[model samples]
Target: MSSDLVRFDATRLAGMIRAREVSPVEVVRAHLDRIEAVDSRINAIVTVAADALGAARAAEAAVLAGEDVGPLHGVPFTAKDSIDTAGVMTQRGSPIFRGRVPEADATSVARLKAAGAILLAKTNLPEFSYSTETDNLLTGRANNPWDLGRTPGGSSGGESAAIAAGMSPLGLGTDLAISVRGPAANTGIVGLKATHGRVPMTGIWPRVPRRFWHVGPMARSVRDVALAYSLLAGPDGEDGFSTAGLGVDAGVGREPSRPLRVGWLVEPGFGPIDPEVAATVQAAAEALRGVGCLVEPVRIPALERDDALEIFWRLHVMEVKPAFAEVTRGREGEMFAISRAMLAEPDTSVADFVRAEQAAERLRDGFADYFGGHDALLCPVLPIPAHAHGLSEFVINGRAVPATHSLSATVPLNVTGLPGLSIRFGTSRDGLPIGVQIVSGWWAESTVLHLASLLEATSPVRDLRPAI
Candidate 1:
């Protein structure tokens, strides 16, 4: 692959378009070609805009007439199915959401359009964005671009796969925990879960998770993620959760000149670590050292030896049950068996809900105090690399792990209401991608990206495309 053709970093694409070195039509054609060539094997995108060429022509015409194009002017992008796009069939990968189309776009989607981005397609997701593996009844399972046998990670799996396969320059992924970050680890890309409420969720279907959900960007480069984020963050009045007008800054371009005071936790706070996962994280730490960052092993005080991981799971089940119920009602739409099973066993009660909320408060407070001095917290995104879908449900090291809550490290960041960024570090011994997750304090997205950009600058994972 020629570097110029395959390189679709948001910043670079924006620059070339701004300089008129490339036409919007050419950019769209390149992406469309990639999708046609690679999406068949991965099944990453459920819908490709039929009008994409015409839209690109309009953008190209604007450029020719010397109209001021927006920052993302004519750049192609994708969003998970759960986010509504006008006139498009948003099959949230469920039979229920099958034909569901919103009259308007989600705020983030609107923002991207306002900034000159062209909406090209809706990526696949788990049923209702509920699971870790991207298998749903409507769109089928999304494969990892790296190894088709393994999963591309969950909920945002399609977005990760699509971006990794070079079908889109940027993607919008809502992280209800591991949905975004996990797939980035699995597919070798950057996925970010923005600070809660930083991006509006108004047009997002069944927004009951209310507290835990976050919408952010995924891309091949930290700068690309950061650029997309700058356009997506801030408030839209419709979402009560919008953190607009807070005088908060997006904080791009702030780089530390010297070694960063970084904290590392090898243990997944409490869960099991596949040996290869641990070594990959440690290797990333060593690489950071080479980049002038002081990496130190540190224990997170927020995580108790008890069931802190359980607390996140219970809370997730609580948030998930109602939303899942709303969509899968009457079995009206084609629902994934996983979603059907989850609905049948909706065991989360009000007591569990209260306890989960309380635990979350405690978790947030603990991290608030802990990050008072550190630049960022780096850890493994998953214990094991991408395994077959149901392996965790069986047994790992003879421990009866909850098949669904395998995303323990990632859920904590969501439950704690902090921003998290996942950067691909290296492949495990089995050749599955390994993700190093960097979590930051509240509204500290800029700091998180600063560290992520450094790692991207120093590591080889920045452009490790799966040779499909």
Candidate 2:
């Protein structure tokens, strides 16, 4: 029974709770036990509610009264600290925000709570959730469960670590660039960034122009990702850019039946992919074909000379600089290295920011045109697997690559305001995990999940638990 409960997915757990086969208390206890056993080694979590037992018991009593349980009943989940959690220390990994608490929940958190999912706790993230690596001045660093020496990934690194280590069944991750997919890629979990504004960003920090920022979900399976997404999606009234679309459930039981036409690319936006990544993508293509789906290697014309990085940087600077300037006003030493550099930029002028925003609008228009035909485009989530933590720079194919390009494929999707997700495609020869992104154009999460499900059915990454 213990093994069965441990192995149950969120969808299965919800069913068990609804059927009275499992109580919310039992589910929460099991997860707390798991977290207690693994969290110290990873430092993935900074807070845990000891009275979670009381909450779960109350949930069980509500269920016994025949209350209409939300779709995610009895599911235990965690979120990155970058997001605000009412009553919990929602520090964004900076001492500047140490012990800071919000008076209300983030819209995403409110939605999940409304869905009957337990908010177990919040996980760590990079300082201000800025850097791709998930270490900060507050909670130290998150170690990869697979290899303790390597980073799990970041700014959702703590969430990814917890999910990979089986400390939590589902986690909420935000992806401005690789916050969701990076840790997902490094930790061998599913990370999803729904279309820009698909989910409300009202409570996330530095909520500026709706350009590159996105809130996403990370879990062990694509089905879990979709389930979490459905609960968190739709408009919250304040984030005017958020979609008012109907949210669809895509759990294991609620999965689509048809195979999708998956158009994929082994090479990323600019050029050739890592040999291992290319091979894995090809293997996924073969697996898709075996499942009676038509998979083809296609070039995305939008991937060429897009100036995506420039647009993203310019827009981010314009928004973030002012927000930070208000607090750190004149305290240039208080900003992170990247934020400091961005603050120093005189190039992102009022004229330049306007033009960049217009360019971004054009990019979004082009993506909408491309997704008219393809269900989803499959590509490497990152150019390479998890590198050693704090490597300062990346050396891709003998070229000194910029640190920002470490997770290039997923970021451009953010810039385009499209929906993208990372799934564990394959493992490296050394056993490190490789991730692949299935990107669907703006607000088209259903297609992305459909293709991801098909791929998962074919090339399944088996339960390779990180040795915590």
Candidate 3:
């Protein structure tokens, strides 16, 4: 029974709770039990909110008392540790902030709670939520439930792992580069990176590169993701960048009038894709075509530039340097080893930042031009499937490249502040999950999600789960 509850997505659980078929306490307990049973091996949860059961009890009483409830009332969810949780530990997978707890929930968390979602726990992340692999000196690593020896993808790795492993039904994760989408693609779930400033980021850490950062939903199903997206999006008037509202429904409506036009690229003008990964993307394009969409191969030449990563790195490093410096000022030894090394590196010059910014502008314009003709771009979220632990670089098609290069396909959306949605499309030969990215123009989340839902209805991996 507990296993079944954990397996049900948030939307199903919400309906059950609302119908009085299940009490919030029962729902929370099922998840808590699942966490206690599975989290030791997964290490996905960093802190189980101490008052989760209390909140669930209150939800039960409210339901019994006939109080009006929100769409997600009594549903359990988790937040990435990098987001403030109001009395729960938000260590950010770094010893630098070890044992630290926030006094206020991040805007998204507060909104979700207000909508009647129970805060179950905080999930793991890379140290300071910095890397693509979720490991740090503070809370160790979050292993892939699909293959314990492999990674679940990082920054939001824990959230993805937890949701994939049925430890959490839904989660909140922040994305600056590929944080959320990478993990979603790696873990066989749905992760939506709404347009820049579409969701408030009032209490998420590493606020530098503020314009590019986004906080969105990561869930087992697109419907649940849409539900959470509606709850969390829009400005709270606190974050300067979050001034724009998410102007459309959470991509839950009908298909477009005419056949949608989608452009796909497996190589995506970046890293070499493993043949299997490439095959899955090709299969996705074919599937879109199978579903009555006009699918074609289109390449944005700007993405092919070798300097793309350099520009992202330069801009990222410049933006985060102050935060890194201030945090590591006297407590350098407490920082993640990678972060320490990164901070010790010499800073980029003004000329380099300026050039990178200009490059970013060109890249953004290039994508804008591409989107002018394409409703969405279909591509691989990563060049390869989830990999083994402690891998510093991935050998794609025999040539070794920096592991962070995995972010190549997804980072362009971040650079342009466009909305990108990742959904499971197919699986690798070894049974690991493989996903395709659907990226749309700025504020086009509804369009992307609508198309993604159409694809989800036909995805072979839609109902699949890791055999953990």
TM-score of each predicted structure versus truth: 0.93, 0.92, 0.97
Better of 1 and 3 by TM-score: 3
Ranking by TM-score: 3, 1, 2
* Model 2, span 35-135: residue lDDT tens: 88778888898777545677788889989999988998768888888788787778888767778988888999888888888889889888777778878
Off by over 4 Å in 3: 248-253
- Clashing pairs in model 3, backbone N/Cα/C closer than 3 A: none
Per-residue error (Å), model 1, residue 190: 0.1
> Which one wins by TM-score: 2 or 3?
3
* Predicted model with the maximum TM-score: 3
Q: In candidate 1, which residue pairs clash?
A: 95-333, 95-334, 96-333, 132-154
Task: Quantify all predictions' global Cα lDDT against the true fold.
Answer: 0.80, 0.78, 0.87
Query: Highest lDDT: which candidate?
Result: 3
